[model samples]
Target: MKASAGSSSMLSHIAYFAIIILLISFVPAERLGNAEEALILIGFLGAWRYSWASVNFARAIYFRRFAYPREKERAVKDYASRPGAAHAYFLTTSYKIEPEVTIPVYTSVFTAAAKSKGGATIVSSVVDGADERLIRQVFSCMPCDMSGVKLIIDRIPGTGKRDALAKALSLISRNCPSSSDVVVFVDGDSCVPANIVDQAAPFFTNPQVGALTTDEAVDIPQPGFFRDWFKLRFDQRQIMMCSMGLSKRVLTLTGRMSVFRADLATNPDFIKLIRSDFIDHWRLGRVNFLTGDDKSTWYWLLKNGYEMVYLPDVRSVSMETQPKPTFFGSAIALMVRWFGNMLRTNGRALEIPSRRIGLFVWWSIFDQNLSIWTTLAGPLSAITAAIFFDPIVLPAYFAWVMFTRYMFCAMISLFRGHWFPVSYPFLLYFGQLVGAAVKSFVYFRLDRQKWTRQAAKGGQKAPRSTSERLKSYGSIYLHVLALGWLSLAVLYLTGAA
Candidate 1:
């Protein structure tokens, strides 16, 4: 039954692709004259804007250095000894079932916390059918004492998984002593290093620091080519963006790891806002929740005039996986859901009257939608220049421009001492094409389903996993080429392409 349904979906997708190809082939070349030329010019302008923004963001990251290990230890000792010393509870949220790769890291975190002089309390919240059995199976494998960890396995009625998590945190806050210092939210998949708490401890030195977010780095064993490329590119982009601090007013604190003062979490207005129906809304004035819960929390904290700091030295390693053969389809489905949520969040945000919030709302909209404009501009510009402009010169120039930009990014990735495989540039270009198609499908229709994780393929895979998959799809490319040639021949016979 499942096989038949999967087959039917594949057929439908192929049919849709065929129709699009036919439509594009039939588009009269002459009609692309002026509009295409205009798009090409617009594309150049958009590309220039993106380049400048990226550079400024990169500059910001470079200058904003955090404290070293020894410096951080000193700060932590000072804060721990203060009159009203900040005590933090490590709140770990998990769906009863978690990935096997994360278990070891979670155990390591508990071990580190136990060794800390200040002593951190652990709150493990589990939902659904996830209970003592599942937790024991995963946690027992780790060499850590589970006695200090407080576990809650209660079921949440009439709420989604994410909502249940928020509720659990809220409940935890209510039960804590009024004088408790801080509440640090950490995803189950993330593993905190031994010195992470010490590094982050200093941010509390500033009375205004309501929350602090650490830089997230991924750790994977024997990553495939595409996975390595993605990590390098993504890390560089994130680092550059963080450095700029352009979106400081609306900076997204990653959900994987962040610490907030307990007092802020106990705020009546904040708790009310999180628990309200408005939380269901996608866009909250100047606060965007497009990326997920972390963004929503960051938006709320910033809007309330609370200071949020980015502590690069406070690092946590997260486990990640590469996209499989059906990656494009999955990507489109996920992006559609995210884009719809973002649009909804933006709408909610516009209701706020604060000027700073208003600017943030508008900027978030622009920044998030930049890819859409660039994607459309690329193809339209290419086809238009091919029609009216000096086809040879313009097309070659555009290709060179794109290649140069990609090469520069690749170089930067390498300079950052991250993995930049030889075929990374090609993968980057392919990724852009995939993104354009996904974005187009998303904007054309709204999808309101929660994103589902794809199950990993069984069996051990080679390090060149993506490359192997590409080779496997080589036959499909041949079939596509044959079809393309047949279509072109038919077009010529009918005087079309």
Candidate 2:
């Protein structure tokens, strides 16, 4: 019997583009343009990404719409009556978030906690006393049955997320009822989907699935470029996550909302790692994790061989604010923080061999490192061709990019359940090229970490000690060297040098 499920990739997917290029070559024109080799290289990279993305996109849809439903049903049915204590703990951390965002968030949370079967605990880890008061007021005003629910206020200094989470985890560990229970972490500005608990808690019934994170959508009250940008990002996230979900693992247990089995969440070692996780850089000494608490949890789960699920249908709506005044500024700030977290853990995570971590999951992590280089290849190649080889290459490159990216967006929109905005193509390329640059920057300066939301206070400045200063200078040299080599290779490949 002939097989048919999976076939063709990279060049196979973009043969039509090649055919179009070939057809263009036959036209009566001067110089035939410099798009041949330049586009071929660009075409291959784009095709590979789109090809891989297509596979993930399909897998994501199957898992979310069909496969996951079957597995979830089996889990719910299998463990329906075999449980002992099925308590859930809602651990929410709200620090410096506005009242308007916090109130509705806690209200939805309190309601979710109250509705769970064996009762739940709401541990509000707050920095400001006002946040605690707001939470209490919301809990008090809630109309649901409060008999089985327990409320705890974990007040802490405005240190950082890690400290707050560490304290909250300690509280959960101390009062955890049973290993069969679940612990859900909710960010302050996020509202859980209706019946989130009922939908998510059932997945933990599967013994192999140690944790699960749901999809997220922006619910910002104010609308603008930032809002649309966030929407596009979330759309991309949902597909990628769903694709990862198929392999019984996901790259992240996102901070917006994620559920962990009580046994895993309450482990002392796990709590300790969350509180103080650091990686030793060969050159930069010890790099402490100041933010990206979500990353710490992900590394722990992956290291422990825990299976993670991505619940695409059950999504939490997060209210986001632009961290900087301008979109470009805010984007760079977040990407620096975001990609830094990934790069820091990525080296360590890659140390886990494929046989142990599963091949697909291992490759997914490896792809992160590869993407920073690969994403830049097309644009770099296109620019080189346009500058020296042929000016017509620019127009051809732009046209090809617009056409392919729009097609890519249409597919994403089909899966995302929202029509991609007109700016999707431009934003897509801008994010890819700019994001690659940011990733390159972060990969070198992994030790330089700070929270994007916090004010630039004097004490929080990056280390100025001699050793740190020496490393900072080395980072620039290394970044320049890497890009220089990349540019040289692109030139060599394009025959421009």
Candidate 3:
């Protein structure tokens, strides 16, 4: 009966949100002409914003109360290891363009790995339906002396998006040989630092260390308002969440770059977890729950008492491309998928005997959901507040909210030793408004289950040429100018300026 009550509550919550969204669509703008309508709008928006702020404050307090006591002794001990043999694995799942910038980075990584008495392996897992020419291009970019570094490209049978990644990991686990001690996973586009092995090697000394992830710096400067805003907001959030140790439950270990023990990779159960078809089946309504590859791996390791370490020193640089038109759509889809997956994994975590894992699961859900809700409420609150209050004050209030949120984000970035970009606060505000609007649309459509390949935000095609990239940047400039004009027009029309 208790379980039934909880299920009913969840269903009701979904239904309430659905009804609110539907009502919003039907609300005539003309109806909001009167003071009463304005008051109603103010009440709605104010309540939502306050709720969001309250939640954020609550989470901040909770994190402070349960802050993981950083073990300085353990940190010191982990840093004391002599640089031993290192192994770098350039893991590529897509049959796409041979990344020119990445090749030199890989060469440097391998040289460093070899000097550290470590070996290197290049693993490529090809999707069966991907272009053959693309696969050949990837092969052409690799060094010819395939002896010291093994190259394996397996054609997986499935059309699933993650199938290629699973196949690559499987091949690495099986063919890389037991002699290889460390398995560093780097995506095709990721540039590795020369000192990556030196920074990451110390973590392996601890038996509990199953995996390690490093900080990623966005390579290209953000071109336009949208791209700059998103990059700033995203980078700041990642810094905060990572510093809070939230990445321990990270589902996608960032195909950008990370390192793991070869033994962990070789585990049959780990491979099975990564390749699970649970999500596909669940999306078809065949199952109530699903789990993704990376999440499953973390779950398995935690269940079996293995610890995942994060090293801020081992850094990777990734070139930032313009956001595609489908970028927001893809983000919403991914978040919805993760919401369902987290529910299932958190359930499993609850059943486990360890208190630490249970705590991690609880905090992970709280952190992610609360952050998303806060972002959504930002624009909703601003629009709603405009209805009841003098329109002139709306922009100031909205600006305040944006600055407050950005300040928190900037603090996180600073704590991580990164310079907070001057343009970040404005970009964060714009990005939040756009993201909230897109997510609201997706939520109402109830089509979150469908999978769509993401396009570049500026509507540039993949494998963008230099000229195309330049054009996309120009488009961004035009967009910001248009938005500025629109904002001024709205202010004038509303008699708010």
Candidate 4:
């Protein structure tokens, strides 16, 4: 199956590139007049940006393929057979999690830890009383004796995830004595495979590796628009992380599930950083992070010169639940949180010396901010060309979108269970435009947001008075006006107005 999918992905790439070359060659010479020429050039620039991203994505998928380890049973046996092997600890946090999702996640962790040769510890920071009992019940129901494992359930004050995680880290530091122990963090709504320890333990053999993150598959059994969208996000994540893993620098140690060395995770400074980490924005001053706790942890590791790995074979299935009833509403809400997290941390991550991190990873970090605009260039430029240059330009651009994105969707299919959906082309554009717009809004209004799922404000910024609120509105108006004028200027300069 792997071979078949790989071959299909290769053909998709080849066909896409070939189609692009053919389309360019077939353009009518008459359309190359001066006015039409400039508009076409701008449209092609957008196409070029799209082409570069598509190529990089393909390369990333290839690099990720080599990161998955073989002979998994032997690796697990070798790691476990050693005397005085590292003890493994599982730390997870939850808020308003359903019994069905919370129970299976903890159960799987208990089952996996019970089978390991060394002792294990499970720490859960939970908000709901019922979730705590259900998790304890999972521990009690374990078939094997958990004589060596300890279970500590810290009931948080419903402050937020950051607080819950901080509480758990404090508990672990006081109780866990060994710096060499392996600490695995999983979300409340995620289930780890039973062989998780066996798969991840062997990687710690390389002392340079400070942390490891695993591949994920979302469990959204019910059919709906959100289900397919959730799967697509995971699929893209696998390819991107795989590519980034080849360079030994994954952008984020996914909060869904990641393994870290106890020394780094429980360090006094690391714990404090995770609890109150804030970035100094040029305009916003010190902005405390409200979400993206995973990113905070990741940035800490990168700054300290720790190598991070992506284990493609180690799978953690996350439960997918839509917070909003409408697909568009849910997508926007999620992106606001997700992209807001990225934009907030992006500044500090970029400042880390490239010598410590590689050039590829550094450039990739920079690209996140630029991608918002580049991703939208195609539609925006094509529309401008259609309005002013030639109607044929729009038709040609649509043709390219159909052919290239369909092939891109085909390549993505290699990583998913179901074939790529017909709606993917539309969904692709929706995610691109909507995600970029949300990223822009959050970039400016970094202080004005909340964790929609958790029902918590992302920052503790004090409320502004009426006059201050009006000033903010004025700033937004000027920014929007400036952008509109800039667009018109560019169109006129390019002879497309």
In order, the Cα lDDT scores of the candidates are 0.54, 0.82, 0.52, 0.76
Which candidate number would show the highest lDDT if scored against the true structure? 2
What is the Å distance of residue 270 in model 1 from its true position?
3.4
Q: What is the lDDT of residue 96 in candidate 2?
A: 80
**Runs of candidate 3 exceeding 4 Å displacement:** 1-90, 98-116, 127-148, 153-161, 175-180, 246-252, 279-284, 287-292, 323-354, 358-361, 374-393, 409-413, 416-422, 433-497
Tens-place lDDT per residue, model 3, 1-497, is 98996777567545644544555555454544533433443445546655644454444334333432343235446555544455656565443434455454455444444444356676655544443345445445655433465555566654543556567767776665442366676654566776666566655666766776666776645455545544574465454434434334333355467777777776777766666634322222223222244556667777786666554435677755543455555345545454444544544555566475556445554444344444544344445436544354354454445545556555655554565544565555545555544433322222123222322121223425775455445545654564466455434433345
Better of 2 and 4 by lDDT: 2
Considering lDDT, which of the candidate structures 2 and 3 is the better prediction for this target?
2
lDDT of 4: 0.76
Worst 10 residues of 1 by lDDT: 281-290
Instruction: Kindly report the root-mean-square deviation of model 1 from the true structure over all alpha carbons.
Output: 13.4
TM-score: which candidate is best?
2
Candidate 4 lDDT, 6-105, residue by residue in tens = 7885686567567666766666657745346445655666666667667667666666554344433444566666677677888998888888888888
Clashes of 4: 0
Q: What's the CA RMSD of model 2 in angstroms?
A: 6.9
- Estimate the TM-score of every prediction: 0.68, 0.92, 0.62, 0.87
Task: Using lDDT, rank the candidates from best to worst.
Answer: 2, 4, 1, 3
